[model samples]
Target: MKSALYLFLLLLALQVQGQHGSKLNAQQQEQKSPHSPEDQSQAEGENSPHIKTAPSNYDFAFRFYKHVREEVGNSNIFFSPLSISTAFAMLSLGARSNTLDQLHKGLAFNLTELEEQEIHEGFQRVLQLVNDPHREVQLSMGNALFIDDRLKLLQKFLDDVTNFYYSEAISSNFQNSPEAIKEINNYIETKTHSKIAGLLKSLDPETVMVLVNYIFFKGYWEKPFNNLSTRDDDFFLDAKNSVKVKMMHQSKPFNIHRDEKISCWVVEIPYKGNAVALFVLPDEGTMKQVEDALLKETVSNWMHSFTKRKIHLDLPKFSISGSYDVKSLFEKMGVTDVFSDHADLSGMAENALLKVSKAIHKAMVDVSENGTEAAAATVMEAVPMSAEFPPPPFIRFNRPILMIIVDKVTQSILFIGKIVNPAAEED
Candidate 1:
């Protein structure tokens, strides 16, 4: 008997705050700072999964972003590449032969360099880092499997997913499609704290199983923007099209870098926890050049080249969401067998042939003056600073720009996208 497995990946990053920082320069801060991400990875040794998987994850992020950019054109772009990669990695547990090879290759993992066990362990470590209790950020990620009542999964596969991915399996009556859909959607909504709802519009009655993954993240600014300082400002979409947005203002010493190669200004904003947001504003008409140069090495160089400097910053408050049917995109990346009948997911169950029928990913992010409502109540600590020697440079993000949210501990990019129109919730 042949049965179809549906994969649904939902990611929500709500109430993500913009930059806030003390007045101290970068050099003075460097003396008090801990090891860099690269140093920490090296200290953790080569056996660490965090060290082994970061490059693969980053490569996958860039590849996915390029594809999504091409597909969405000039619309507001946002997505959690980590979320999609995690789901696909989980699915690879049940895959075999070419399907498994394709999954690993699509994820930018080299089988010769990293064994499958090491890759899975790397993801496990990344998940642990993301949910670390010591961090001030609130992040929770989990996976679930909804199995039809009639199907029996392999005990080894079940145990592996539970042990490595921390996934939960629940039996569902898929013969009743509406009930199954409601159950899945409700679970996702609860997991994301109502940030996501009704994720499943419809489900096939023939589906034997559904694999789900969801992530919710909320982080506070170390120095939050004052609500009184935000005002309506113009956000230029182009030379002629402009929209009014509530632009947040701040004048503080921040890590800033100018990339002449791409003709862009890069600003790094720190969160209260182990995360930072990078904003890249391109020269007047050099967005295409910047976009084309979004390689991992370019980002690494920008991070290393930053110098602490005072700047008059003006950034808009925006909320954006994106939903993608990435099955075709995955096929475009050479992961085709899983969605077709050629899929050999025999490792998942006995006496059954399984193939993925659908792959859907949806993500939403909200950037505001003080992050999430829960984080808004916390008071920011006051820090003393030396006087500026020179008048600070003024930087305004009035035009379209690129944004990336990264976790410092694992050096993983949590979310990456661009905002062309702040007013539009969806494009």
Candidate 2:
């Protein structure tokens, strides 16, 4: 039997309006509180090894975001950095020499500070944490290696991915591009519960192996907005242009902070479980300032500075997806050797020279009054809210906004992107 490990993240909210009837239960509310004693101890303790690599992952997240932003321009942006990182990490198992070093560096890992073993162990810990069955959220992550039946992979490489990364290896005939593409896409769709489909439009016939990583997350807001409050509003694209969108409204107490340095309002909206969504609304013309300041320390400060306040929040009811051929992007990030003929993937298989030919990534997110539903997949072919006090600030996401979803347990960022226009579907 092929065991299905569902690994993805989604945020879902239902239609409601002008009512507090959908408030979180006691347990959910407790999970929303920041800096809990247990959370603090876990961060300072040895139990949470994934914390060590979080900084690296975040660094990669921001860098990748900048690259994608530059490529897509002002279009709506959404992609799972976690899925991308995980796929590359699994690929690193087969990487050697400069190829391996480039992978580590591109992932923003400091070899001097953390050993290679520690890095893999950290990811292992993260996989365990997110897949915890008892957690209220439905979140899962998985990896798969579809290898050409003609090539023989190293036993050690196979063992490492299975034991450390929870990956499954299946024999594939890449020469049959259509069948291979169909099989891989079907597997990903099933894993993400159909949130992501046709992740690979086509596969290279010369491709000896294709590595894939996927994540599916579904989380409901602790405080859902009432559907009655949703109405048409303008979402400004810039100083000159705007688009009409169905804006969801809610007024309630929320964890909010103002970062004067970046000139943005950071609001933390809790999900019904260990995840939380962060909406960063930059003041007019300061979007670039806030984006440039995206760093581990910057986000940490925002999380620590949050204060409960009642405010009226107006957010767009939007759904967006982003797809990219990350081969060029990875090269720009200094991961060149892996894609070139000078590659050293000898650790993967004996007597065969292997290199990643193409790497693709796709992600989708749906946000409504109910919550959020998001799913993402990566194939290496090779590869908010509100609230108020004193009439509380009426913060409306009527312009470009940044969104970040995080898992409190591991402090791992599940997804991050910008919504320049709610009406745009893809970039």
Best by TM-score: 1
Clash count of each predicted structure? 0, 30
For residues 1-427, what per-residue lDDT tens digits would candidate 2 score against the true structure?
1111111222111111211333344454555446542355376665455878888999999999999988878778788888888888888888889999999999999999898988898898888877765565667887888888778889999999998899888888877889988998888878888777666766555677777788888776767666666789999999999999999877778999999878999999888665788999999999988998999899999999999998889999887887777888889999998888878888888778887777877787877765321210111111043332356788898999999998887778888889888898454
TM-score, per-candidate, Cα-based: 0.90, 0.87
Candidate 1, residues 1-427: lDDT per residue as tens digits? 4578888876564567633432232233444335434345547876798778888998999999989888889988888988999999998998999999999999999989899999889888877767655445677888999999888999989988987899999999999999999999999999899988888898866798999988898876766777667799999999999999999888888999999988999999888666889999999899889998988898999999999998999989888999988898899888999999899898898778999999998888888886333444354545467666687888999999999999877878889989989898563
Candidate 2 has what TM-score? 0.87
**Candidate number of the best lDDT:** 1
What TM-score quantifies how close candidate 1 is to the native fold?
0.90
What candidate 2 gets wrong by more than 4 Å, as runs, is: 1-47, 371-389
